[model samples]
Target: MTDRELFDTYRRDVYYLCHYMLHNAADAEDICQEVFLKAFQTDRQGVERIKPWLLRIAVNMCKSHLDRRKRGVLKELKHFLLERRRDTEAADEALERKENELETERWLRALPVKNRTVMTLRYIHELSLQEIAETLDIPPGTVKSRLNRGLRQMRRDLGKSNPNLKGAECLE
Candidate 1:
């Protein structure tokens, strides 16, 4: 496909994937642009599945960006905390829901990259186990183990913070 076609077809998916991975809209946009630029500059004549190919590019770009700077999580937490203040202007119910969502995001952020990626792909993006394995270039068994470990960690963290949280026991 031409560059324009590629961008039109996959721009939203790429952007969301980057945003989900990085939790920063501006960085996601920059990486999305870079992903397409790289795709355009290279030869993709033999690419069989564009979705996975593009996603792999996005994943690598996000990993490199994270590795270059260790403070990304702190920056994102700060951004979320600041954003939470803005939510206070909304209705009480909405504010409560937003808080819960933010709390979930925080928990997800605490996870290691591999676990976070697997969970995001499996739950948020609703990919099958096999698809996640292919996307991450790992075996399905490894994906399962990482997902189990990640969930256990999240449960442990949540349990320590809030013993009454409903889903902590479900993680067992």
Candidate 2:
């Protein structure tokens, strides 16, 4: 496929993957462009699955990006964002949105990077276990273990934070 076609077909996938991993729009956009630029430079004739290959690249890029920075600041920023009350037409809807945001942030904070990436691939991106393995270049069993461990950890973390929170139901 041409560069434009490749980009158009998978930009959202790539961007979201990066955004979810990095938790920053500007960083995700930068990484997404870098992913496509690298894609444009590489020979695609040998790549059988464009989406997975692109995602693998994006994943590696995000991991590297994460490694280069201190994570404390990002967590602080996210916590700050979650603390702010939004102005909305529907109080119930706003409450639900804020709840979801806080839940997501908690989940993200609870898991390690590897486990978080696995969870994101399985839950958010909706990739199968096998696909996650290939995208992360790990075994399928590893992917399953990561998911299980992440869910368990998240459940414990959520439970500790809120007595009424149904961690397993939300996680599963």
Candidate 3:
């Protein structure tokens, strides 16, 4: 596929990754745009691996943004944009789903940065072990270990915050 075509196909996934990584939709959109722009500016050889390359760029952008970030920017942006959606019955369902998603997101946000990234890349983005290893520049074995450890941490946290959820047993 051509660069634009591949980029279009993967755009939502890239945005989702950025949103998950940054924990804010607006910054995610910004990073997604930046990643695509970087891809567009790349040479043909670089464009050949655009999916993983774009993910790497998005990851780097989130990391940079996090490292020098001001507090509440992400939260304020999220709250500001939350009520601006179109009104409809289907939109109500969507809003409900968004609520659940946001709750899950809050749980994720409480985790360590590395665990959050690992969970987002492994579970949300649905990347293969090798692809995640490539994107994170880590070994496949390490990715697996991180996945296990992250899940364990998430379960423990969830059990504490959610009265209905039992730690680790929730997975069963």
Candidate 4:
């Protein structure tokens, strides 16, 4: 497939992955653009795959964006204390879902960046361990370890106040 065609097919998925990682739609769009731009610049010769390549680019862009964002936030005490509020209203079911999602986000925020990336790729993107390893350029064993550790941390976080939280899948 041509670069444009290949990237077009995966754009939404890539954007979702970026959005999940950055937690900001604007940053995710920027990262997605960077991913596609990098793909356009690279030599595609001897390349037997496209999705993994695009994902690798996307993941690197996400990490870089996160790093820069971290440094920027560190420089401002007032900005560091500010929180981004969710804008959506809550229905009964929506409220429950949002609560669970917020808790998951809290858990995710507590883990190391690498482990959080693994968990997002594994659970949100629904990528296989092998696919994740290839995309992240890590060994499969390392992905497994990060995933396990992230899950354990999430479970501990969820179980802190409510034992019933353990009965539901953390992602739910």
Using TM-score as the measure, the top candidate is 2
For each candidate, what TM-score against the reference?
A: 0.70, 0.75, 0.71, 0.73
Give the Cα-based TM-score of candidate 1 against the true structure. Answer: 0.70
On lDDT, who's better, 1 or 4? 1
Q: Candidate 1, residues 1-172: lDDT per residue as tens digits?
A: 8889999998877787888767788988999999999989989988877777788888888878877867454223222233546646667877776777687778878988778788777776667788788778899999999999888888888888877766636354
* lDDT for model 3: 0.70
> Each model's C-alpha lDDT?
0.77, 0.79, 0.70, 0.73
Q: Considering lDDT, which of the candidate structures 1 and 3 is the better prediction for this target?
A: 1
Which segments of model 3 are wrong by more than 4 Å?
Answer: 24-26, 44-49, 68-100, 161-168
In candidate 4 the C-alpha lDDT for residue 100 amounts to 65
- Model 3 per-residue lDDT tens digits across residues 1-172: 6767967798987887777667777888888888888877767574445566678788777778877784322321122223445354486787786886676777667666666677777677677887888888888898888888878876776677677966456664
**Model 2 quality (TM-score):** 0.75
Summing lDDT over every window of 10 consecutive residues in candidate 1, give the lowest-scoring window: 73-82
Model 1 Cα displacement at 106 (Å)?
Answer: 1.3
Taking the candidates one at a time, how many backbone clashes does each contain?
0, 0, 0, 0
lDDT of 4: 0.73
Model 4, poorest ten-residue lDDT window?
73-82
| Distance from true location, Cα of 58 in model 3, Å | 1.0
The positional error of residue 38 in candidate 3, measured at the CA in angstroms, is 1.6
Task: Show where candidate 4 strays beyond 4 Å.
Answer: 66-91, 164-172
Best by lDDT: 2
**Where is model 1 more than 4 Å wrong at Cα?**
1-5, 20-24, 41-48, 68-93, 165-172
